[model samples]
Target chain A: MAQVTLRKLVKMYDEVQAVRGIDLDIADKEFIVLVGPSGCGKSTTLRMIAGLEEINSGDIAIGGHIVNDVPPKDRDIAMVFQNYALYPHMNVYENMSFGLKLKRTPKDVIDGRVKQAAQILDITELLDRKPKQLSGGQRQRVAMGRAIVRDPKVFLFDEPLSNLDAKLRVQMRTEIKKVHQKVRTTTVYVTHDQVEAMTLADRVVVMNAGLIEQVGTPNELYHTPATKFVAGFIGSPAMNFLKCSLEQAAGALRVRVSDTLSFPVPADRTQRYTPHVGKANLLLGLRPEHITETRRHTEPNQHDFDMKIDVVEPMGMETLVYFSVGGVELCGRVNPNAGAAEATSMKLLADLNNMHLIDDATGKVL
Target chain B: MTDTAIRAGAAGPKYGSMSRDRRWALRWSYFFLVLFAIFFLTPPIYMFITSLKTSAEISAEINPWWVFNPTLGNYIELLTQDTFLRFFRNSAIVSILVVTITMAISVVAAFALARMKFWGSATLATGVFLTYLIPETLLFIPLFKMFAWVNETLGIQLMNNWWTMIILYPTLTVPFCTWIMIGYFASIPKELDEAALIDGATWTQTLTKIFIPVALPGIIAATIFAFTVSWAQFLYPLAFTTSTSELVLPVGIVTTLIKGDVFNWGQIMAGALLGAAPPLIIYAFLMDYYIAGLTAGATKG
Candidate 1:
């Protein structure tokens, strides 16, 4: 039972803080992914957990034991690098068995574990081939096999799939998820790709500027982002934000986006949003999928408005329509057959049930 | 003429000119290649020819380059002579010892400088290569004096000893070998060692098992460099060792075979050919690795 914990973890290179003070608790058997844009400290945090980087001032505990001074090998952790750092001279079997041999594990036990890992990764046929003889995907499997043969407390992957081609990357994503389901080892995977994070992680840790923006399950982060950064980062066609102000209209709060466009706050959030009525620096944050073509039957708080489409992108199953709202460009997803063409007007529905009101001044979602 | 014949005649001159240009280029390339080959190979061929000739026929001068009557007398005499055998033995021992010592010190030093960087490591790495640039011609004088001082102060003879070459040769070979190895070691991705560290291998184990094998080509190149440098070196052995029994091949053959206006041309050629054999055989076998290691150092890191 190896649950990793970090308390006030900080890393500094010269005067630059690569990782700011952060606290986290990773439960046993949990698969956590740290993801963000480049230089957001995700890779640095993973390296620190692997004991490859020194903590500037913090405590890292694995299985409830402080491992601040423990070396990487003694931490009982395995890391798969981006480049698949397999021994070029060693065959796949020897590569998998290197760690065990280093620990002086018995020959038969090492053999059994390697063969078992090769079977698990479905690389048994490649046991005799050297690393150079393997394809890129096959080499990636051998790297993972090398890590799995150790059966360590935690598996640390440092952007292990970043080197594969696009199609191979998606294929390996499912392969990784399947392996995690079978092995059930606590894993920490880092990547800048949000889709990989959402698909592979049990919970995603969204980081920005050396600080974690939010941590939650994929659906939680997508539907209810706590910060503007998280909302913008977690989706493919990112959530759109339009400059607006909340105004009190009779007993309801209306989010006024422009002279002709305004959305009434959903009834469920009226109480929470009433205090912020007439507040300046307000933004209407809504996802592209929430604003779509007017449906046959409208649900509660769904408002219909006409938008002159500025651009159109037909993406096979869905069409992305772009239009101007208060001088800010906004995107909406409609059915591909809805005929979203550039320079054309279409009646679109704005679903306020999924709308987010953000305080642009502090970048907080209210 | 027929229509096809007229078309073929019109196109022939243009196509024929291109082929003529290519043929001339090929002829000139081979011309210089053979010229350079003969220029470089003539001396060795002449040495082999002289080694096969008797001293009487060599002096007759009927045709200096040709052997009127060839004999194995020179080879047989040198092989039987205890002094010549001793010179061969001394050269072999010195070269083998220097190569071993040079590799041991340089491999570890290069690994430390390239991977396990510390304070001033970059400057020190550059400093090592700079030391190699300080030609041995300049340092040999100082080194000769140092050995002299050691002899006077300790009452132990440092001069006229073949074993002293073992200590002196590494000063020349280690710096350059370490420089070559530093390039090779630096070219290996940093993730490799980090992976090894997480795999439970200590620094020593990583160097022995992972690095040494991966850099084997560089090691072979450095070994050849060390072996060749020490085997053919002339100035240090001549300056330091004087006695007949205390000489290596280059110094031994020159000092003994050419005594006071009388030169043993046949025996000298035979000795020179035999002395050249070991390095020739090593290069012949490991030439590809030697070239790879050399170019990798320049291009990789």
Candidate 2:
């Protein structure tokens, strides 16, 4: 296993820049995930690191060796593509052994490696079956087997689970995590699924529009997103943003949303937003889980407010309640037994400890 | 009771007319198909019938369709003749050699044009297809003049040799085969080649180990086309090679079977039938692959 470092990586396709000046240091034996929406340059970054794409201007060093001029075969990296990319003409054993044979490994070693990989992927019975005969999940296992048998220094996955059905994607997601744990190879997995990134990566690199937005541990990203974009992109159901302005009211910093609904900023975070006082377009970011119906866990910074519920969806474990706050739609998580009903008034608590105050103009967490 | 009556009345004509329309459509399709089959099968049937008849029976002023003396005489005679065997041998050699040359050149050219992006490769690919569009009738004259110039300057007589067909046939086959192969090669997913490259295979190794095996159906289709063209080519072989020994099957059968004013119909029919057998056998065996290769690019793109 080796650390892959990318310094000032830039990729330009004619006039369009696909990857722009990305610098990341992926440590040895660390599972790093690059997650973003489509066309965010995450896959392009992975491909550049794999040497499958030419770098316009960058330095990519794998195991402390610069591979800028190296061909893909000499990159000492293996990739699992989204489509599984198995040779349709070859059986499972042949497909797995192809790379080793190209390396001119001994027959016994090739057989042992292929069989071990197949055993790891649970595809031992499919050794003699061609790709066309296998189901999609089986083919995926075979593709992984092909990559594992190479035992490359780095493993690159470009949306490898996107083609599977939902349940199988989840199953294979855990399988990949298990495989990485066992193999402990330096891996960079690219996917648009934030949940996959959170579950799999030792570090999650959130990218947007050809630039890295944020890089941190999953817990750091979840609890303290560095930007408005990262906060919105990382969570499922997404964090809600309410456009409000900060003003000094009676010697305490209070955000004025409307005539009646305004809450004081937390005492510790008040200093961060003090410079932006009288700013009319500050955004208040809140996750769904942070807005609760119960008041027993409230701190000194927490505040309670009343709002009319527009719709309520029971999710078995918890309930999701949607309501309007100062003409902006916001979702709050509540207890299923809280008796939420449409168009009815309900009391909700906002935990200010986890709230994010963002600058509207810059979209940055203040 | 009134509602039930209304529902039945609303549905009655629609269901009946739908069945009637489908039946008529099926009948028309089969009728046209049989008509087309008869039109296509008549010439081969006639050739087989004529091949089974003696010269006496052919010119006996009898019923033209029926053979009074059904004979294997023509078949036995053609099979025994040294000249006929020589023509068959020459044609076989030319067709096989042409196939090998065409496949080799086309596979590499197609891979380079389709997968390997260089300067002006798109234009070059279009130029190749455009070359295929240029008729052999138009190309043969200039090719003949060039051969003559080479002979005058380089002291090489390429005009009357059987192996010259091996050299010249690719001019006809390569452009077309290359175009077909370009389509086939382009139809394969780009990821497969990337996977092969990452698997430690070089470009040549990828072509041989991954591409050639994956695109085997296309290669077989191209080989069949090349063989058929070389075997059945008439104008070039006739213009270039005058000797009976050097002539390929198509020209040999036509020239040797007919003397100045006499057409040897029985032997000519027998030779033509025999000349067609190789391609026929190949198509019979590989028809599915041929169709797949032909249509792979259109459907994929």
User: DockQ scores for all the models shown?
Assistant: 0.38, 0.42
**Model 2: clashing residue pairs?**
none
Interface RMSD (Å), each candidate? 5.7, 5.2
Name the regions of candidate 2 deviating beyond 4 angstroms.
A294-297, B1-20, B288-301
Model 2 lDDT per residue over A1-366, tens place: 498999999999999999999999999999999999999999999999888889999899999999999999898999999988888778889999999999999999999999999888899999998787778788888888999999999999999999888999999999999999888899999999999999999999999999999999999999999999999999978999988889876667887666888889877777878898987668989999988895767788778999999999999999999998778899999999898999999999887788888997898898
lDDT of 2 by residue, B1-301 (tens): 9999989977899888998999999999999999999999899888888988988888888777777778888889999999899999999988988999899899999999999999999999999999888888897899889999999999899999989989988988999999999998998889889999999999999899888888888888888888888889888898889998998889998899999988888889899999989999988998887565322221111
Q: Model 1's lDDT to the true fold?
A: 0.92
lDDT per residue (tens digit) for residues B22-124 in model 1: 9999999999999999999999999999999988888884888888788999999999999999999999999999999999999999999999879999999
If chain B of candidate 2 is superposed on the true chain B, what is its TM-score?
Answer: 0.92
> What digit string (tens of lDDT, one per residue) describes model 1 on residues A161-210?
99888999999999999999999999999999999999999999999999
Interface RMSD of 1: 5.7
